[model samples]
Target: MTISLHRSATVLFQGDSITDVGRLVEPDSPLGNGYVRMAAERVLTALPDAGITFVNRGVAGDGVSDLRARWREDALDIQPDVVSVLIGVNDTWRRYCSGVVTSVRAYENDYRTMLAQVRDELDAQLILIEPFLVPVQDEQWAWREDLDPRIQVVRRLAEEFDAELLAADGLLNQAARAVGGAELITGDGVHPTPLGHTVLAEAWTELAGL
Candidate 1:
């Protein structure tokens, strides 16, 4: 689906560490070193005069609730024409690693809340990216039980909100199978490697019609 972007449109990138990729710490690299940067670079290269401005507000360990709490400062205030979000895995990760559980109901609620605000306040086009896992270890497989339901929530929300959907999980998994293993795509089940970021960036640029 084409999520149209006008010249001088502002696009905001939001999510967890996958989107973060050390953006906050690096002064010169506000877009971080992940898909957000890659996608922006690709778009600029193709459309030199598009005048598109890209912003990354993803925090390393944020969950849906965290996004909701910071929405005004990080999202609405930016007044972006389009917002692309890649969240959810951390909600599941906390359950497995830190004993904090974000129930599926809560995940959907918080996410919906943020989207509603965006719709009401900004009227911006939305692109909801699927939170994916490319299991490299045995235990990571168990995360599917928690993460898969959230993925479905993202799909449902995209349809409900008339937003574009990117099946990042499906795309990366296909790549992993094609290349023999997840090692080349993602060193860990959650974070994308350089090649994996390229996959996400290419898909995002195409999806956003950038």
Candidate 2:
């Protein structure tokens, strides 16, 4: 769907490390070096005079709860014309790596709360990106039990909120299978490689009609 933005529109991207992509590490470049940047570049190139501003507030190692905790300051306060979220994978990651499980119910609850806040408080268009995993290792496949439910939650929430939904998981997986293996898609099972980032940016730009 093509989302209409007002003049001088500000687009904000929020999520975990994949979205972060070393934003804090390279403070001079707040947009980081990921799909967020690529998407912004594509949009600006298409509409050079549109006066669109892109902001990335994705924090590495963040979960849904972390987004909830900082939503007011990081998202709402920005008053963006569009808000894009790419989260949930870290929630699954933490469960396996640190035994800190965010149940499906809790994940939905937190996600809904954040979306509700955005709906009530802002006039921004919402883009809810599905948290994806490209399994390069044997054990990463086991994470599907946790991540699949969260992806469904995102889809449901997007429908509920009249938001744009990006089925990134399936799309990226298809890309992985289409040409190269999972390793070419992502170095690990979580973060995207440069090619993977391009795939995401292309999909996002097309979906948003940027």
Candidate 3:
């Protein structure tokens, strides 16, 4: 299957650190170092004549609110045909480590609002990637109670927005269990290793049919 949004279109990626793996911060270099870069590379290689432009506007530690704040400047201004987003890990992580409690209700509300803007205002194809954690440490396992609900919210939002859903969480967990465990994928419980990112990119590609 082909991802038929718009022909020869520009695709914009938005989210937190996982997405913002050090994008050049210059127009000359837009693809970051994580799944975004890998996905772009695959698209270029597979569809060399498609002439799609890929851009990453993910900030290292952004939450749903942060993405909302920069939506116009980073995303809307670009007027992309497809907008892919992976967020909510920081929202859950902050509650665990920084006493910043982003309740499930609040997370869902903010995330829905952001997606609505993309759907109504920009008229773009939306791809919502589920936030993931591999449980490398004890504390990471506890994060499930908080993170799982947010992941559910993303699924609901995807349905509401008629968007594509990329189940990165399940894919990574299965990959980890198939190999060794969470440690091999994510050294900590959050950030992914190079191999982990590659897994994510491949999963996204397969799910998006790109």
Model 2 lowest lDDT segment of ten: 1-10
Candidate 1 C-alpha lDDT tens digits along 1-210:
698878999999999999999899999999999999999998889888989999999999998998889999999999999999999999999999999999999999999999999999999999999999999999999999999999999999999999999999999999999888898899988899999999999999998665
Question: Alpha carbon lDDT of residue 110, candidate 2?
Answer: 92
Clashing pairs in 1: none
Least lDDT summed over 10 consecutive residues: which range in candidate 3? 1-10
In model 3, which regions exceed 4 Å deviation? 24-29
Query: How close is each model in CA RMSD to the real structure?
Result: 0.8, 0.9, 1.7
lDDT of 3 at 188: 84
**Number of the candidate with higher lDDT, 1 or 2:** 1
Candidate 2 structure quality by residue, lDDT tens digits, 3-36: 7755699999999989999898998889999999
Tens-digit per-residue lDDT, 1-210, candidate 3? 335635589999999989988774645556778888998898788788888888888998998888888988998889999999999999999988999998899889888888887878888888899998888877678899999999999999888888889888988988899888888888887888888999988877775576
Alpha carbon lDDT of each predicted model: 0.94, 0.92, 0.86
Ranking by lDDT: 1, 2, 3
The candidate 1 region of ten consecutive residues with least summed lDDT is 201-210
Q: What is the TM-score of each candidate against the true structure?
A: 0.98, 0.98, 0.94
